[model samples]
Target: MEEKLSKEKIVQAAFQLLRENPELEKLSMRKVAQKLNIQAPAIYWHVENKQALLQSMAEEIENHFVAPKPKENWKETIYAYMENYYELYQQYPCAIEIEIQTIPSYPSRLRNLDAILGILNEAGFSIELSYMTITSLQHLLFGMLMDSSEEKKLYNKVMAGDDYLKKQIILMKQYVQEHELKNISESIQYRQKEKQKDFFMKTLRVFLNGLDTFV
Candidate 1:
């Protein structure tokens, strides 16, 4: 007997496969079908191709992200919203990569964006500025998250007896120490290797404070 494959089921299988193997470069629809014990044609019936499959996987991951309830302090609410997805993307490693590669019109994601814009609009920002501000914040966050992931990978490599990180850090410290700029060397020594969530929260606070000047 052939297994019945609904679009929802296909998306779910694809998500599970991604969770197991997060590299988008290696993902395939046939792999997803294998995970579901179904034929590739079955998956293709619901999702047309690889791009569609990736978008479907993105949709499935966004299913867990909730737009925060409205709060009296909309800035705080917006921070909370971005922080939630930031952390969610950290969990779903393929999330940002897929999001970067595809334009997924996932409903929940759109609602979250709308809610963020709503917060800014309520806080007296014009619609145009609100859009720019939110996108700018998102761009900053994408950079940070990508950096954090790279940092984690490097740290893991160091743990695995790779002296490449050891050498690189030593060289970095040497360069900082040699830099004659007053206090720059000292600041480098005290650099923060903060957990990503805490780091982003503090960064977001500073960013929001800066936005106040625009009001």
Candidate 2:
């Protein structure tokens, strides 16, 4: 008789598969089966389908990232959450992709949001400001984490090189100037340069400056 398998075991297997593979496009029932040494049909017995499997994996990852910890200050709480999220995405880039692709009604996300909302309230920010601030923070961190996770080595390589991006920007600006579209190109160039200036830190600083007005 075949040995009975538990759902936890199946999820564990899925986690192993996710960690081993760099790309999810190559993930399939057959591949999962091969990893577990079980038939593809056996996987369906644990997860309804591939989407269900991916969803479960995403939930597991979110759980790992959003756990509560003792934080005395709102800024520390928010920064701690963002730092953990960045680290989590760095380790499991696949989970970040899965999270972006799916709209999860998971408890992990809800709990984290609730905690953030509470922290903002305690800091005397209005409900609207609190909601918008949390949303903005999530967007900034998500963008950074995704960008870093997807191309960490490539980004480091580019940054380490002798100003390749800067050289391209200068070339583009010259072309734009000669074409009499300097304003449009300048706006694009300005935004790209702004990113290099640690805009996330600047945005948070500005938001904090306005916190007193909100209170």
Which candidate gets the maximum lDDT versus the true structure?
1
Q: Write down the lDDT of every candidate, Cα atoms only.
A: 0.79, 0.71
Maximum-TM-score candidate: 1
What is candidate 2's TM-score against the reference? 0.67
Local accuracy of candidate 2 as per-residue lDDT tens digits, 1-215: 97677566676676678677657777776777787788888777888877787777778777777554857877667666666676676666476678777667788877877877888888888888888887787777677656656665456556788487658757877888889896797687776678532565566556555665656
Positional deviation of 123 in candidate 1, in angstroms?
A: 1.8
TM-score of each prediction = 0.84, 0.67
Please provide, for model 1 over 39-78, each residue's C-alpha lDDT reduced to its tens digit, 9 standing for 90 to 100: 7887777899999877877877788897667667877788
RMSD of each: 2.7, 6.0
Worst 10 residues of 2 by lDDT: 195-204
Query: How many Å off is the CA of 208 in candidate 1?
Result: 0.9
